[model samples]
Target: MATLEDDEADIDPVKMILLDEEGEEKKLTTLDNGAAKPQMQKHYIRSIESTVAIRQLPSEGLSFQLWPAATTLVTLLDGYLSHLSESPLATTLTALSNGGDNGRKLKILELGSGTGLVGIAAAVTLGANVTVTDMPHVIPNLKFNVEANADVVARRGGTVDVAPLRWGEDDDMEVIGREFDLVLASDVVYHDHLYEPLIQTLRFLLNAGARGGEKKVFIMAHLRRWKKDSAFFKKARKLFDVEILHTDPPKEGSRIGVVVYAFVGKN
Candidate 1:
């Protein structure tokens, strides 16, 4: 519903995004090469769809065409089904199963929500109000996927919004200026260049400003890349009162690791 993306800035929906076809640079066999530089160009097209069955391109530039690597987007239409563990599906379901007697209707937002799985899972299983966001580059495809599938989300009385959000630099949280019940992000801490900016963004968008929950409440998921991810987490912990909210790395040949994080407040 609210967004702030500079049209001039080029965006790559899949790569920088956690939920789509884009990959972790350390894992990318190409960018890992020392000889390569940040060549400003677009190269590929990958078909990605939302749970509702709307398909769009994840990689929308350059000459390369991409294929979904078992990870893709989900929508409200799928009714919040989760194929993976380590996801909040079970947690949310438990809470919601109580039947809202807790005076708690959750308002949640997910940063870098790839195919909308987590958000969708929360929406369906927990019936939390959710928002899915990503870079301007990925907004088009993200929205298209959401549009294609609205059925799943509609059933649980869950509402999902797709917005444009960038990890680094200027952010527009004002348009979305209200406080949230739960904030989440997945696979967003792998970039060194984005380190500080990501922290700043979190502080800006979260942190209850001496009011709300006495701090911000957030849960983040990432596949651990020791050096890069640990460094970021260590520094981030210094900024917020943090706890190892959760962790469930893939066993073997699972292709990815999964960890959950919860931040209480800012330092």
Candidate 2:
């Protein structure tokens, strides 16, 4: 896992490079908005044969930047949609009928959707209707990225709606609703102070459909950077059955890579 400083180092680049379909690196054209130029990353979704462009406003804050774990989750989603037999997401998503032959498109809700990368990718890959949410202040950037990739998402028969959802806020949670088939997030568990709020949000979502005999799953991709991260998982385990779905190999200069986990309500 990369430390906060290491993640910050990634944002220092002045030129944002995007890959062409042929895999050649090309500089992304900067969009001047009377302020700092937004950093744009183009993630190629092979399943849809299209790319989703995500805009990051680094000047805003950490919530506006792309994170490592988000990229990992996007890759897994691409693999799953490609119907690759070896995709690590097969077991979990198949169980949820996310991209199965269920006839109905999967409905997903994403928490802490920084830059809206994973949510956008999921919509494109699975043709799922995804609601991407974040702090109220972050909603603008999320909407920007979602709109930027709207055509590509529509081509795949998917849609992405942006919303503001503060963690642990019951009113916000109620507004968003718990009718989703699955919940997704990446790089959400970090600050110790946020553990309880995130846990409360998870508890609210995971417990919603239990009485109706409907199983709602929360799949999170996390890169363990601090020893204290264990405390978040420990507390989460008390209410949800948490299980590892996949583990990415460590990236260069990192001791551990991103790990994907599935959390379901305890009976």
Candidate 3:
């Protein structure tokens, strides 16, 4: 007993049908909260993937002031796994990328870790001990996210430590005693004004070098912009033997720029 109005409504279709990861057909939500959150908040996730190797980032307002960020994060970790010959970390460490040798249990440090995605991914992927550090204001979310990723750590057989570190602070470094086998930073160079202090922190955390004394490998992922300074790369090079290991364009015809820096600590 359908009326003309009912037929018209059916034809119009209030919502489009969509499929979930499991391929269940469902109506697309008109009010999609998953797109992005505006509030500065934090939420937990018990799981992320079945890889048995990946950390889950807390979903709520996790201070991601950086853009092209979530995807870029995936890229950084992906690069870490694939940049076999490109990465400048300890030879033994890089050798483990293929999971051929999971013997490496490195002490890693991540600075300016917005939500600990890059560091968490590394810890999960490499089974390394990761120390994720950011400013005090950013620590709570970082800690929450790390906890959210507990399953990932447990499955991957690695540990992630969250801590607070301020840029350009000497006393802080003296207290923390930057001792790490690998150093990572992602999307941290957006603020040209804060570059020097950020670089200083990197210097403190990095291991000696591939020469095998104190320093170790350091990797930084960034989005290149037309307005960015050419000297930025030069400055990093002057401080350490910096090299370009990988560059990935925006994903799937998307408009985003990304590049990773592989630095060999100078003796």
| Candidate with best lDDT | 2
What's the lDDT of the predicted structure labeled candidate 3? 0.58
Among all candidates shown, the one with the greatest TM-score: 2
TM-score of each: 0.62, 0.84, 0.67
Between candidates 1 and 2, the one scoring higher on lDDT is: 2
Cα deviation of 176 in candidate 3 (Å)? 2.7
Write candidate 2's Cα lDDT for 161-238 as tens digits. 999999999999999988788999998977789999999999888887732467788999987666667778878889
lDDT of 1 by residue, 32-151 (tens): 434332222121211122233334332343111222221222221122334243334445434334433455666777776655545655665556688887766666666655664467
Off by over 4 Å in 1: 1-58, 61-104, 168-171, 209-214, 253-256
**Per-residue lDDT for 68-183 in model 3, tens only?**
43334444455455543344433435543333225647777888887676677777766778888888878877787788778867787879998888877998777666657677
Q: Which RMSD values do the candidates have, in order?
A: 11.0, 5.3, 13.1
Q: Give the TM-score of candidate 1.
A: 0.62
lDDT (C-alpha) at residue 210 in model 2: 30
Lowest-scoring 10 consecutive residues by lDDT in candidate 2? 8-17
lDDT of each model, Cα atoms only? 0.51, 0.79, 0.58
| Colliding pairs, model 3 | 41-61, 207-215, 207-216, 208-214, 208-215, 208-216, 209-215
Ranking by TM-score: 2, 3, 1
